[model samples]
Target: MNLGCIVGLKEWIVPQDKAFFDLFEQMADTVNEGAVFLNVIINNYVDVQNQCHKMKQIEHQGDLIAHQVYEQLNRTFITPLEPEEISRLATALDDILDYIDGTTQQMYGYGVTETDDFMKELARLILLSTQEVQTAVRLIRKLDDPRAVEQHCIEINRLENLADVVLGNAIKSLFATNDAITIIKLKDIYENLEVATDKCEDVANVLSDIAIRHS
Candidate 1:
């Protein structure tokens, strides 16, 4: 079925729009799995690329529904929560897919043939951040618990910070390797991976804002 139909059915079937949030959580998990697989084996690049692309499509559908829900909530003057909260959540979820798509495109464009320890670590961090995102979504779906959301946001931010340090050291080491061509390609790939982590932090920031406002 089409996205609108699925979302409409979800709104009709589930009480309080819980199923909508659950679908977003599943999308995050799918993206996380794709990130982890990308890091594990270089030969699996095509598979991960396809998977990430599919996940992006799903995420886009979710974003559309979120926008619709937000608009409906605004017009109705009565919703489960504030309009800003829904908008923030929708935008943050969309950002996650954008980052994932960017990472996959970079891998293919760079012709990455092998994985390194630093890249592996970055992927791990991305997975951790996505997991935190899933947690935040789950909490928001249920109690709208500000404290729980804040805790997960903090964890995501911390993980993103660690990714920055790891990326910096990796760049330094790459420069010292004395291979100009390799350094150029590796640097681009590393930077894109780091960018993905940064996007995750952006999502966390939005979630933190939602928590503050709702608290």
Candidate 2:
């Protein structure tokens, strides 16, 4: 709170801004990679366990980045963005990876060795959503163009709606089939994919909030 302490704190935070944004971009990249892996696994229907392992690694990487973000938040007396916004964005980004990891694990646990069109479509939608997320997060560093940032958020919302429709039709088809256990297994996977988009929407919401505040 004293002058000298304040000056030292400001100096410390100067370097952290770049570091924070760098980590955020890296985290977004990793999440998008996970989504790509998920789509590949679903479309090919081979080596799923190994692919799930890869996604787990990415999820671990996201955790490490999130931890660093929080550690920096705690140590710095000043931040490039609001401390709460930083925390929210970090948490939201982490959740997207977490859901991706969850979907991969469920595929293995449910013995879903075959790929279906619905699953593939959902996976593709997830990939698209994450791509938008990455773009929007990077644009945060260039928020002078608020319209540009909001466009990405709008795309994310549209993708989320598309994912919802995919989920609905998937569940509807599953119920029409008489294989009860298969229905149960696929229902879980479908819901997880949907939840992943929901998390992506969560990221979009946080990004929108940040843009509004900082615009």
Best by TM-score: 2
lDDT of 1 by residue, 1-215 (tens): 99999987766534455444655566556556555555553434456556556655655665565566555555543445565666666666666666666666666666766678888888788878888887786776655479989899899889989999999999999988988988988898788778877877877887787677667
Please identify model 2 stretches exceeding 4 Å from their true place: 1-10, 13-15
Quote the positional error of residue 138 for candidate 2 in Å: 0.8
> Which 10 consecutive residues of model 1 have the lowest summed lDDT?
37-46
For all predictions, the C-alpha RMSD in Å is 6.2, 2.5
What are the lDDT figures for the candidates, one per model? 0.70, 0.90
Per-residue accuracy of model 2 over 1-215 as CA lDDT, tens digit each: 89999988778857467877888999899899889988878887788888888879989999999999999888877788999999999999999999989988998988887978988898999999999999999999868998888999999999999999999999999999999999999999999999999999999999999899999
Off by over 4 Å in 1: 1-20, 40-77
**Residue 87 lDDT in model 2?**
95
In candidate 1, which residue pairs get closer than 3 Å at backbone N, Cα or C atoms, i.e. clash? Answer: none
What TM-score would every model get versus the actual structure? 0.74, 0.94
Worst ten in a row by lDDT for model 2: 9-18
